[model samples]
Target: MFAPFRPIIKDPALRLAAVLLVLFGAHAATMAPYVSALAIRVFGLSDSAYSAVLLVASVLSVSASVGLGILADQRANRRAIALGTSAMLIAGSGLVLAGDNAVVFVIANALILPLSASIFGQLFALSRLAASTHPERDRPAILSTLRALFALPWLMVLPIWAVVFDHGAPLTAIYPVTLTLGILIVALTLAFWPRDGATRWPDPKSGLTFRQSLREMANLPILSRVVALGTINGAVMLYLVVMGLVFAATPGRGASDTALYAGLLAGLEVPFMLALPVLVGRVSRTSLIWVGAALYALHLGLLPLLAPTPFVWLLTIPGAAGGAVVLTQPMAYLQDLLSNRPGAGASLMALQKLAGDAFSAAVFAIGTALAGYELAAAAGALLGVIGAGALWAMDRRAARS
Candidate 1:
């Protein structure tokens, strides 16, 4: 069980990536569950406006991710990229903290924060490159272990946020908390991030011109797989949004309940995440994702119907098992699709995020306009299955070709 982390434990570069990922996850754990609430309930953006902002943010995130990824390959300078994005995170939080309007919230979320989100893909990109030094067979396990470590902070941070919110911290308090995490991220990068030309880290330079690189990613095989996986993974995005909104809108439930619910589900997922490395060769990745999408769809489709009752707590079982697989597998899979282009491979994650966010935004808008949150969640569930099936078909077709 613990064997997966041996590589991370032994390698300083890998160790640095794991530590930084935890801190980054900490900020996300604190901020994400509440970001939707802040946009709509606190800042008074309409549902349509909020979805539009999320759509715009996805654009920024993908642009930063892909541009920096190719540039990272060109210069092999992940440390430089990490430091810059970390500062952007701080600036984003400060934007919201200093201003008190919906427009400011839009700028923070849509521009600064989304650009900063590129750090996430870059972090994995760094680790993937570093892990290349270890035995080839150990690579998947090493990545999975780091991913679990990323989720580990949520176990601790979300509960803390619950306590803080319970004790009457303002909803906007997440900005200052994120501000602190951002500063620590920058400090850590300066203190421990590997040098660009370090012997320990082998940068995979794509060598393609910028236009050529972009054209490669735009290829049908790569883009279609990303889109299919992104659509399937969109279920999680929808779940996150509805979890906060629907759970909060329930008659007796509120912020504390939302926090605890998200915390417990995320908590349950940690073990499964840790356990996934064990299944590395025993189960096919595609098979696992197929099952995961179905289970996740079950979790999402039931969420709105059951959120009002104690029965809702039972969701942790399926949500954790399914969420664990869906959340981590897609990343490793995407990275593999562009195996040699570690930086561009990492950008695939950002692209998946962009596609998922766009799908969720559209689903959320249409579902809510047509009916309500339940309909939105159901739409997410249905699409997850469809996307998963599409991916299976596409991959099988590609394999044959």
Candidate 2:
């Protein structure tokens, strides 16, 4: 297990990037739940508040990510990360400040929460930067390892947040702690990974203008597919996430069993993602994607079989399989596609993020409005099948050519 950990970089900036990722990942897990806990326990909002929280989070994230992506194109990656981390600090603090005023909290969420994307989106920019600077073979491994770091949050912060919120802790109580943590992490990021000129990529001479980047990415075949896949997957994922309440409420399931089901799905993402580098390196992108699409279809197919009993635990295998496919290979495909055109790569990434946000929101809104939980599941099941068919069609087209 430890043998895979070899020294790839002795430089301070790269090391700092890794550390910043850990902190950001932790912040990501805690941020939503913190505000949510407050809304439920302190503000006395209804369960609809949870969906509202996700919608608000999605909006702020998409907006912030786009702005910061453009800023990243124009400014330093470290600077964006710093500003973003600073925003997370402020956002977390605002949750505490908003207290019981649900309306004020929602506004704060819209404005302040999106700034956290500065940190989240910066990681992608930084990875591209690192690949540009360092050796190529190491890039996938480096990215995969960083992604595995994301699982740490569920382990460290999520369980803790669940405990606090489970007992009905105030938003005031939770937000302050998360805010302090954000600030400390930001400080560490600055101290260890100081921003400098070289990190500021855009200049008059790079020839990578925003419009040119977007046009170039628009024409890239693989990036287009990746973005499309993300759009579909994101919508389905959001539908599932929102519909989880229904799954939990499915007749005989206890709250503990539901929590266990969710945890299994989260925990399964790491090892599969960790193995993606090796898998993508060995398999053709088309082949890997087709396999993934098939697995995703199977996973969603199995979901309906899950009941309130211990048998539901078996559903995690398909769930984890689907996550592995989404988290691992499409990224490597996008990175490979972007190698000759990093600017276009950045734009494609932004597009991917935006599409995911928009499509997920649309699905969630429509799914909820149509009916309650079971109907939503039926819709999600259709999406899974349809998405898989789309991928299969794309694969067949590629094969013919």
What TM-score number comes out for model 2?
A: 0.80
Q: Please, what is the whole-model Cα lDDT of each candidate in the order they appear?
A: 0.87, 0.57
**lDDT over C-alpha atoms for residue 115 of model 1:** 88
Per-residue accuracy of model 2 over 138-224 as CA lDDT, tens digit each:
777776666666654644665665566456664466566667767877677666544546553332223456666555556757655
Tens digit per residue, CA lDDT, model 1, 259-282? 888888888888898888778689
Best by lDDT: 1
Best-fitting candidate, measured by TM-score? Answer: 1
lDDT of 2 at 12: 51
- Report the error of model 2 at residue 163, Å: 4.1
Q: TM-scores for all candidates? A: 0.97, 0.80
